[model samples]
Target: MDTNLSNYLKKEQDKLNELLSAYLSKLSMPPLLNHSTKYSIEAGGKRLRPILMKLTCEGLNGDSEKVYPAAMALEMIHTYSLIHDDLPAMDNDTYRRGMLTNHKKFDEATAILAGDGLLTNSFHVISNAACYSDTEKVFLISKLASASGLEGMVAGQLMDMQAEKESISVEQLEEIHQLKTGRLLTFSIVTGAYLAGADSMILQKMERFGNLIGLIFQIQDDILDVIGDSEIMGKASGSDEDNQKSTYPSLLGLNGAIEHKNRYVKQAKNLLEEMELNGTLLEKLVDYLGSRNQ
Candidate 1:
């Protein structure tokens, strides 16, 4: 990664870690469940979802501090998804961020409840009136709910699970990602823009950018599973093939997957160019993602 991209990602991610620590510290829940929740929250991650949110807000001359709670909520939602995804009933993974996964570090029941806690708590964080009005909070919560619910992430996960039993076309794969990954990524952009009181045109542009960025990220993930290091990825490599699931590489071959990832990144970068907002960092971020192996 370029120095600028590397520094920016690290800086924001560190900030998020602090914010999450402060927020989670105040929670008074069951001991084991709370520990399970904090286990994954404190576990190191890219914090990419929250950073995407804060950057869009910063681009619009908005205060990131005001958006911090909502940004943290995004990360919580993401972390919950990862915890559940790593469960025995799901991907059955045993490691994340170079440590035992939630289900492994703690009992499966505790991990499952911990994921539930994070998912539901995200709405409360977004709906809080710390940084925005009730109307705006409602808008954020509504969008987030749809994105994380059956209409979006749930639908995508369902498709992924069902596809494990049979072949899926490229079109079906795209639809699965558009809901599963695209909605939340788009929500990251849209939520920040809504907080900043951005005009509808800019919101529309962000919507398009978010969708392409999601595809770029997911396609690259598929490519990495084939050629990435398990140590660097913090999980076993080639788990996709091991589970007999379809992936970009499985459907389109390694070369084709790389081409598609590049195409989507370029499309996202082009959208950044057209935005009136200064999205240099976002463009660089998109470009950087194309080469991110882990």
Candidate 2:
């Protein structure tokens, strides 16, 4: 990855932080509920989903400013998923983003409610994207909902839970991760295309690119869990091994996981280039993914 791309992602990430803070401040709920919700939403994360949404919009000739609300909504959904995933019944993690997991910091009930609030509130943010035409707003909202709901991330999570400690085929693992990790990513890119009124061909290409990157991202996470530092990863490392979860690195050898990640990264870059779209930022984003230390 280029050093310049890392610098640029840092700058773009700062803007995402500002947007998150501003949006969180505007939220209105009962004081206790609001505090619970804010606790996890404000916790630091890489904010990759929103960044991808904004960059995809920019790549397809849409205004990033106009797409910011939708982008932020994506982040909320992602964060909510993380909150829920860390519950004792799920991954049972105690740390996240270098801070206590919501359940650990607060309590399981509060963390559950916080996740619920964030999930419901995410739609409000997307619906507020009415600055665009009714059709565009409707399209984006529907797409995001599908990605976050049953047919997407939820399905993936269910599969993951069911497959824990069991041997799964390569195809099964891919299916699980694609749903668990790839669907929202697909929505992020497709939402940008809808807002920009891009043709079906462009949307299809972007979808392919997003799916490829999403899988690559998961594979990298699996690799990191095996080899990454706990401090840098902000979560327990080697938990996949301890939990006996089926992961790419578990199903494939460590070397195989590295090979798979490199292959997907190459495929993602090729798809982006084939789109012939001005994805300078998106290209940099993909390279950064390939090079991310954690």
Candidate 3:
């Protein structure tokens, strides 16, 4: 990874961490509820969605701070999804980010509630942030909800679970991920551009970039699950395979998957070049995604 990109991402991650901690601390809820919610959100990992949002804002010459709450909300949604995804009825994983899964660390009920708390609080945070207008807040909330609801990640998860009953095609797998993971990722980038008041052309380009990045991310994750170390991924390798879930490497061979990843990486680079906006950080980010070890 480029030192500059690493440093920049670290700085933003730190700020997001502090903000999340502060917000959670202010919750006047039961101790268990607060603790469980805090545990999952504070689980150590890359705050990728929020970082993408903030970067989009900066690349558009918009103040990233203006979008901080939206970024924070995005993280909350992501954290909530991870919590739910690890439940017994779901993937049933016991570890994440090298730590016990929320349900294992806490109880299942608490974990469920914690996921709900995070999900519900996300909209509140976005709508209640001080910097953006009520109109902007409404738009932000709508986008998040839509992307998170039946039309987006949840819909994708539903398809994924159903597909596990049998086998699925590569195109079906792609569609599942496009909803389950890609939509929100796309929302992060496009929302920043929308809030920044960028032109329609700019927003369209960002949508394309976000979609490709989302696919690249999922593909890399599948590749990692096959070849990655548990110590590095902080989860069991081959969980997808173990769960009988389809993935890029499963559908395409390992080498083929790597080739697919490379193609998207190239497309992302070309997209950035075409956009010609704040190229340095974005370029480094795309490169980092392609090359990161974990």
lDDT of 2 by residue, 1-294 (tens): 577666766777788778777777887678777777778777757778777877788787787777788877888889889999999999888888888888888899988988888888788877776576777778877888888799999998988999996789989999998999899988888877766778898888888988998998888888889888988777778888998888888889999989988999888888887877535878888877876777
Tens digits of per-residue lDDT for model 1 on 152-259?
Answer: 898888888888899999888889888888899889988777777788998998898889878888898888899998888887888899988889999999999998
Q: Residue 176, candidate 3: how far off, in angstroms?
A: 0.7
TM-score of 1: 0.96
lDDT of 2: 0.82
TM-score of 2: 0.94
Best-first order by TM-score: 3, 1, 2
lDDT (0 to 1) per candidate: 0.84, 0.82, 0.88
Instruction: Give the Å error, residue 67, model 1.
Output: 2.1
RMSD of each: 1.4, 1.7, 1.2
lDDT of 3 by residue, 1-294 (tens): 788888998998899999999999998999999889989988848988888888888887887778789988999999999999999999888888989999999999999999999999999898789998989988898889999997899999889889888878888988998998999999999987887788999889999999988888889888998998888777788788887877888888899999999999999889888878535687778877876778
Off by over 4 Å in 3: none
Q: Tell me, by TM-score, which candidate is best.
A: 3
Per lDDT, the best of the predicted structures is 3
Higher-lDDT candidate of 1 and 2: 1
